[model samples]
Target: MKFLYIFTRSAYGNSIAREALDMALASAAFDQEVSLVFAQEAIYQLVMQQNSANTEKKPHLGVINALPLYDIDDIYYLAEDSSTYNLPPAALVPQAKALSAEQFSSLMSSADRIQSF
Candidate 1:
Protein backbone atom coordinates (compact mmCIF):
# COMPACT_ATOMS: atom_id res chain seq x y z
CA MET A 1 0.00 0.00 0.00
CA LYS A 2 1.08 3.57 -0.59
CA PHE A 3 1.07 5.70 2.54
CA LEU A 4 1.49 9.42 2.83
CA TYR A 5 2.12 11.17 6.13
CA ILE A 6 1.45 14.85 6.59
CA PHE A 7 2.93 16.25 9.77
CA THR A 8 2.07 19.75 10.97
CA ARG A 9 3.17 19.29 14.55
CA SER A 10 5.30 21.82 16.37
CA ALA A 11 8.96 21.07 15.91
CA TYR A 12 9.86 21.36 19.61
CA GLY A 13 6.83 20.84 21.81
CA ASN A 14 5.83 17.26 22.30
CA SER A 15 6.78 14.03 20.56
CA ILE A 16 4.37 14.45 17.65
CA ALA A 17 7.01 15.00 15.00
CA ARG A 18 9.11 12.18 16.39
CA GLU A 19 6.11 9.89 16.42
CA ALA A 20 5.30 10.78 12.84
CA LEU A 21 8.81 10.00 11.77
CA ASP A 22 8.74 6.74 13.69
CA MET A 23 5.51 5.73 12.02
CA ALA A 24 6.79 6.67 8.58
CA LEU A 25 9.95 4.65 9.14
CA ALA A 26 7.97 1.66 10.35
CA SER A 27 5.71 1.81 7.33
CA ALA A 28 8.70 1.86 5.00
CA ALA A 29 10.33 -1.01 6.84
CA PHE A 30 7.37 -3.16 6.03
CA ASP A 31 8.18 -2.64 2.32
CA GLN A 32 5.29 -0.25 1.90
CA GLU A 33 5.66 2.77 -0.36
CA VAL A 34 5.75 5.69 2.07
CA SER A 35 6.04 9.42 1.65
CA LEU A 36 6.17 12.35 4.09
CA VAL A 37 5.07 15.93 3.69
CA PHE A 38 5.74 18.82 6.06
CA ALA A 39 3.16 21.58 6.01
CA GLN A 40 2.24 24.64 8.05
CA GLU A 41 4.49 25.01 11.09
CA ALA A 42 5.79 21.53 10.57
CA ILE A 43 7.96 22.95 7.79
CA TYR A 44 10.10 24.47 10.52
CA GLN A 45 11.17 21.00 11.50
CA LEU A 46 13.29 20.89 8.34
CA VAL A 47 15.27 24.01 9.09
CA MET A 48 18.94 23.13 8.94
CA GLN A 49 19.75 25.29 11.93
CA GLN A 50 17.36 24.00 14.57
CA ASN A 51 18.70 25.25 17.88
CA SER A 52 17.65 23.03 20.73
CA ALA A 53 20.29 24.63 22.97
CA ASN A 54 17.75 26.33 25.22
CA THR A 55 15.42 23.37 25.63
CA GLU A 56 16.10 19.95 27.11
CA LYS A 57 14.38 18.40 24.12
CA LYS A 58 16.42 15.89 22.24
CA PRO A 59 17.06 17.37 18.83
CA HIS A 60 15.44 15.06 16.30
CA LEU A 61 17.59 16.45 13.48
CA GLY A 62 19.68 13.33 13.55
CA VAL A 63 16.60 11.18 13.24
CA ILE A 64 15.17 13.35 10.50
CA ASN A 65 18.43 13.08 8.63
CA ALA A 66 18.27 9.32 8.81
CA LEU A 67 15.06 8.92 6.84
CA PRO A 68 16.86 7.96 3.64
CA LEU A 69 18.67 5.15 5.41
CA TYR A 70 15.31 3.78 6.43
CA ASP A 71 14.12 3.94 2.78
CA ILE A 72 11.61 6.74 3.42
CA ASP A 73 13.07 9.15 0.89
CA ASP A 74 9.91 10.78 -0.44
CA ILE A 75 10.21 13.82 1.77
CA TYR A 76 8.64 17.14 0.83
CA TYR A 77 7.86 20.59 2.21
CA LEU A 78 4.91 22.75 1.19
CA ALA A 79 5.92 26.00 -0.47
CA GLU A 80 2.77 27.89 0.42
CA ASP A 81 2.89 26.81 4.01
CA SER A 82 6.58 27.58 4.35
CA SER A 83 6.18 30.96 2.69
CA THR A 84 3.32 31.86 4.98
CA TYR A 85 5.63 31.22 7.89
CA ASN A 86 8.56 32.99 6.17
CA LEU A 87 10.65 29.86 5.91
CA PRO A 88 12.85 29.68 2.82
CA PRO A 89 13.99 26.64 0.92
CA ALA A 90 17.57 27.61 1.66
CA ALA A 91 16.93 27.07 5.36
CA LEU A 92 15.81 23.49 4.88
CA VAL A 93 17.79 20.36 5.60
CA PRO A 94 20.18 19.33 2.86
CA GLN A 95 18.48 17.98 -0.26
CA ALA A 96 14.99 18.31 1.17
CA LYS A 97 12.60 19.10 -1.69
CA ALA A 98 10.17 22.00 -1.62
CA LEU A 99 6.83 21.56 -3.41
CA SER A 100 4.23 23.98 -4.63
CA ALA A 101 0.66 23.70 -3.32
CA GLU A 102 -0.49 22.13 -6.58
CA GLN A 103 2.35 19.65 -6.50
CA PHE A 104 1.53 18.75 -2.93
CA SER A 105 -2.09 18.20 -3.79
CA SER A 106 -1.11 15.98 -6.68
CA LEU A 107 1.13 13.92 -4.44
CA MET A 108 -1.68 13.53 -1.95
CA SER A 109 -4.02 12.29 -4.64
CA SER A 110 -1.60 9.52 -5.52
CA ALA A 111 -1.53 8.23 -1.97
CA ASP A 112 -3.61 5.19 -1.18
CA ARG A 113 -3.79 6.29 2.41
CA ILE A 114 -2.98 9.54 4.18
CA GLN A 115 -2.58 10.22 7.89
CA SER A 116 -2.01 13.65 9.31
CA PHE A 117 -0.54 14.66 12.67
Candidate 2:
Protein backbone atom coordinates (compact mmCIF):
# COMPACT_ATOMS: atom_id res chain seq x y z
CA MET A 1 0.00 0.00 0.00
CA LYS A 2 1.14 3.53 -0.65
CA PHE A 3 1.02 5.43 2.62
CA LEU A 4 1.39 9.18 2.46
CA TYR A 5 1.93 11.20 5.62
CA ILE A 6 1.44 14.93 5.31
CA PHE A 7 2.72 17.26 8.00
CA THR A 8 1.39 20.81 8.14
CA ARG A 9 2.30 21.75 11.70
CA SER A 10 5.58 22.91 13.13
CA ALA A 11 7.76 20.57 15.14
CA TYR A 12 7.66 22.52 18.40
CA GLY A 13 4.69 23.25 20.67
CA ASN A 14 2.73 20.28 19.37
CA SER A 15 2.63 16.49 19.19
CA ILE A 16 1.42 16.24 15.60
CA ALA A 17 4.88 16.08 14.03
CA ARG A 18 5.97 13.32 16.37
CA GLU A 19 2.76 11.43 15.82
CA ALA A 20 3.12 11.50 12.05
CA LEU A 21 6.78 10.47 12.27
CA ASP A 22 5.92 7.55 14.52
CA MET A 23 3.14 6.42 12.20
CA ALA A 24 5.43 6.65 9.20
CA LEU A 25 8.01 4.50 10.93
CA ALA A 26 5.38 1.98 11.93
CA SER A 27 4.09 1.78 8.38
CA ALA A 28 7.60 1.25 7.04
CA ALA A 29 8.28 -1.43 9.64
CA PHE A 30 5.27 -3.31 8.40
CA ASP A 31 6.81 -3.24 4.90
CA GLN A 32 4.27 -0.85 3.47
CA GLU A 33 5.44 1.81 1.01
CA VAL A 34 5.76 5.01 3.04
CA SER A 35 6.31 8.57 1.95
CA LEU A 36 6.30 11.84 3.90
CA VAL A 37 5.37 15.35 2.79
CA PHE A 38 6.25 18.44 4.81
CA ALA A 39 3.91 21.22 3.80
CA GLN A 40 3.26 24.75 5.09
CA GLU A 41 4.81 25.31 8.52
CA ALA A 42 5.62 21.64 8.80
CA ILE A 43 8.60 22.39 6.60
CA TYR A 44 10.06 24.03 9.69
CA GLN A 45 10.60 20.58 11.06
CA LEU A 46 13.33 20.07 8.49
CA VAL A 47 15.31 23.16 9.38
CA MET A 48 18.80 22.09 10.36
CA GLN A 49 19.58 24.33 13.33
CA GLN A 50 16.72 23.49 15.64
CA ASN A 51 17.02 23.76 19.41
CA SER A 52 14.22 22.26 21.40
CA ALA A 53 16.01 23.09 24.65
CA ASN A 54 14.03 26.29 25.19
CA THR A 55 10.80 24.63 24.11
CA GLU A 56 11.25 21.94 26.76
CA LYS A 57 10.44 19.30 24.17
CA LYS A 58 12.68 16.52 22.97
CA PRO A 59 14.38 17.33 19.70
CA HIS A 60 12.68 15.37 16.92
CA LEU A 61 15.58 15.81 14.52
CA GLY A 62 17.16 12.63 15.78
CA VAL A 63 14.28 10.45 14.73
CA ILE A 64 13.71 12.50 11.60
CA ASN A 65 17.28 11.92 10.56
CA ALA A 66 17.03 8.22 11.30
CA LEU A 67 14.09 7.78 8.93
CA PRO A 68 16.19 6.57 6.00
CA LEU A 69 17.53 3.72 8.10
CA TYR A 70 13.97 2.56 8.53
CA ASP A 71 13.45 2.50 4.75
CA ILE A 72 11.45 5.72 4.70
CA ASP A 73 13.43 7.54 2.01
CA ASP A 74 10.63 9.04 -0.05
CA ILE A 75 10.47 12.36 1.79
CA TYR A 76 9.43 15.62 0.14
CA TYR A 77 8.51 19.23 0.75
CA LEU A 78 6.36 21.70 -1.15
CA ALA A 79 8.73 23.40 -3.59
CA GLU A 80 7.37 26.92 -3.50
CA ASP A 81 7.23 26.94 0.27
CA SER A 82 11.00 27.02 0.39
CA SER A 83 11.04 30.37 -1.31
CA THR A 84 8.08 31.60 0.70
CA TYR A 85 9.65 30.60 4.00
CA ASN A 86 13.03 31.99 2.91
CA LEU A 87 14.57 28.58 3.38
CA PRO A 88 17.19 27.80 0.85
CA PRO A 89 18.10 24.23 -0.08
CA ALA A 90 20.96 24.33 2.40
CA ALA A 91 18.73 25.23 5.31
CA LEU A 92 16.70 22.04 5.24
CA VAL A 93 17.38 18.39 5.89
CA PRO A 94 19.02 16.57 2.96
CA GLN A 95 16.65 13.63 2.76
CA ALA A 96 13.66 15.58 1.56
CA LYS A 97 13.27 16.35 -2.12
CA ALA A 98 11.28 19.21 -3.59
CA LEU A 99 7.87 18.65 -5.15
CA SER A 100 6.07 21.28 -7.13
CA ALA A 101 2.43 22.06 -6.44
CA GLU A 102 1.23 20.07 -9.44
CA GLN A 103 3.42 17.16 -8.53
CA PHE A 104 2.10 17.32 -5.00
CA SER A 105 -1.47 17.14 -6.18
CA SER A 106 -0.62 14.14 -8.35
CA LEU A 107 1.08 12.55 -5.38
CA MET A 108 -2.04 12.93 -3.29
CA SER A 109 -4.11 11.42 -6.03
CA SER A 110 -1.78 8.44 -6.32
CA ALA A 111 -1.58 7.55 -2.66
CA ASP A 112 -3.65 4.60 -1.46
CA ARG A 113 -3.93 6.02 2.02
CA ILE A 114 -3.08 9.42 3.48
CA GLN A 115 -2.81 10.79 6.98
CA SER A 116 -2.34 14.45 7.64
CA PHE A 117 -1.29 16.27 10.82
Candidate with top lDDT is 2
Instruction: Give the TM-score comparing model 1 with the true structure, all chains together.
Output: 0.93
Runs off by more than 4 Å, candidate 1: none
Q: lDDT of model 1 at residue 17? A: 85
How well does candidate 2 score on lDDT at residue 102?
A: 97
Model 2's alpha-carbon lDDT is: 0.91
**Global lDDT scores for all candidate models:** 0.86, 0.91
Per-residue C-alpha lDDT of model 2 across residues 1-117, encoded as one tens digit per residue: 999999999898688788878989999999999999999999999998999998888898998899999999988999899999998878999998999999999999999999998
Residue 77 miss distance in model 2 (angstroms)? 0.6
Model 2: weakest 10-residue lDDT segment is 12-21
The backbone clash count of each candidate, in order, is 0, 0
**Where does candidate 2 stray beyond 4 Å?**
none
